[model samples]
Target: MGWFSNAPTANRIQNTNTIAACVALLEANGQVLNEVNTFASNQINRGQQLSAQAFSVQGAGSQLGRELQAAIGSLGALKTNTSQQLDELGQLCHNMELLIQQFDVPRGARTINASGRDIARVAVHDTSLVLANLLVLEQNSRPDIVRSVQTIDRADTVLNQGNANQAGLNLPGMNFRFQ
Candidate 1:
């Protein structure tokens, strides 16, 4: 039922599969970080625009302008720290993937790795887009939440296919390093 459930050869193949999963995880995390950055930038821009409007209409010395300025200042401080933390996380995930790739992998355990990753990557892309769009829906702007839901459904389908593949779908002509 599992890669490590068999023997040493299976262990090696499992390690290779683990590395593939690590790559997907790292890629997903990177996309998330990029979305965070976009969110922060859009938020800062919105705050600035709001502040400008308040100042122009209420006068630069007005109480509304003063309050908006303070809020924007706080957001600025938070963005600096938030972006730095996200960068560190991205670097750590990248390094982890690299480390995992250094391990040797036995043949015949590699099955549809790229296909699985493609499925996961589509899900990740849609997820980030949904999050970012939700954050900045804008004036009377609407995003189709259903699309994200459908992507999640596709991910579920991919998961089921992966389970079936792992269960007993061994290829006949290939040499399996692990029995």
Candidate 2:
């Protein structure tokens, strides 16, 4: 077959199939990122509430309270960063979706001059770039999630200790309970 020889319909179908597969994978990744974002937001909110409770105690300026405050602050920052990462992932997926929609399968005489290979090449490149960025997002965000969880655990422990210490003080005009 010559350079412009008749390419089989199977070639175009395979190329379109590859592009479709990449789009599906990227869309799935976007969804997972969204779920992670929601979880991080909830964790951040709880951390902030824990910080407030920590400061309400008489020993608000103590080491434990200070640690809780720091952890809560980090969680807020983590949420912000994770949101940005998720947005990037969403955009990548959206672009792939558009590309896949425009991708066409050559039929009949058009197969002789098919550009499916070129389109598939571009799709593959886009997929690779998205995959690399997704890896980075996963690697970086994992540490933040782990750290946030650990901080929450520590804050919970401190709150438990503080509440136990002040269990039955029955101070006048002051009623605070950490749950």
Candidate 3:
């Protein structure tokens, strides 16, 4: 019969329920973020495929050149859209991290007895550390998307250079010419 035993049991139950609810909410937010990441990844793959097709037609004549140009334009547009979506997703994840960090679980009960036996008391777990770790993981994952976008941009540059070469262009100091 310690000070904790004086607190109402109902209040202890309510505090436990609140912690469970917060865990569930955080999990839901994580799932949404995962879905957004999957979408952005798919878009990056599509852009890569389109870029490959465009580059493949670089050495062909006028007809293939026109087709390659069109493909490049389409892929560029897709990359732009995907980049925007990823930025939005990153912002959402940051907001979720902030919310999870601010969650406070109040102390409710400290002692309980079962069947006329005193159970060993354990301290309450602080979940803020776990939530902060999850936020760190989310932040770590963002760089991969950013790198993919940069890679796509580089691929675009390679395609453009190949296209220029096919058109008999040469750098100012280069002895080699496409023609």
Candidate 4:
């Protein structure tokens, strides 16, 4: 009968320990989520920069392509290389988004202890905020990649057309031999 009296105390101690462990886990998860988000965002920024460079090259090639058709061939190859890299970057962003989704942030909305619950809430809130920012970065950067691909494709088309047109013309300085 005396041992039975200590049962409630033991259960309370166990519950408190469980809550503390949960709080620690949530805090650690929040930190990891932040690190992952930062990495993903940085990769996205780099992808955007690469996309811009591709655009610049495409612009210059487009302007110069009218005069020197041979330059278009080399510039078009460069454009292809950059566009492929952008596609890989986009895939990486997608994988990062999926990885972030797998992290199960604990919800403490119904916990009875106000202070522990508040800590859990803040951790969960912070992780969610970081996730949102990552999602925004991903969404925004994806469009740039798409647009870059489209532009590069258009440039390729123009370059091909120019090459075809040049094939039939016999410019004074350039010799045309078709096999």
What value does the lDDT take at residue 155 in candidate 4? Answer: 44
What would the TM-score be for candidate 1 when compared with the true structure? 0.46
Q: Per-residue lDDT for 117-146 in model 3, tens only?
A: 111011112234334444554455444444
Q: lDDT tens digits, residues 29-146, model 2?
A: 6666566656666666666767777778745576656765666666667567657766775776776665554453223334334366766777778777767765666666566556
- Total clashing pairs for each candidate: 0, 0, 0, 0
Give the winner by lDDT: 1 or 2: 2
Candidate 4 regions with alpha-carbon error over 4 angstroms: 1-8, 60-179
Clashing pairs in 4: none
lDDT of 1 by residue, 101-158 (tens): 3232212243323332333354345434433433343211111222222322333334
Worst lDDT run of 10 residues, candidate 3, spans: 115-124
Cα TM-score per model: 0.46, 0.71, 0.37, 0.32
User: What is the per-residue lDDT of model 4 for residues 71-147, given as tens digits with 9 covering 90 to 100?
Assistant: 33333443444344344444444533433332212223222323333433443454444445434444444444344
Q: How much does candidate 4 score in TM-score? A: 0.32
RMSD vs true structure, all candidates: 19.6, 11.3, 15.7, 17.8
lDDT of 2 at 153: 69
Q: Per lDDT, what order, best first?
A: 2, 1, 3, 4
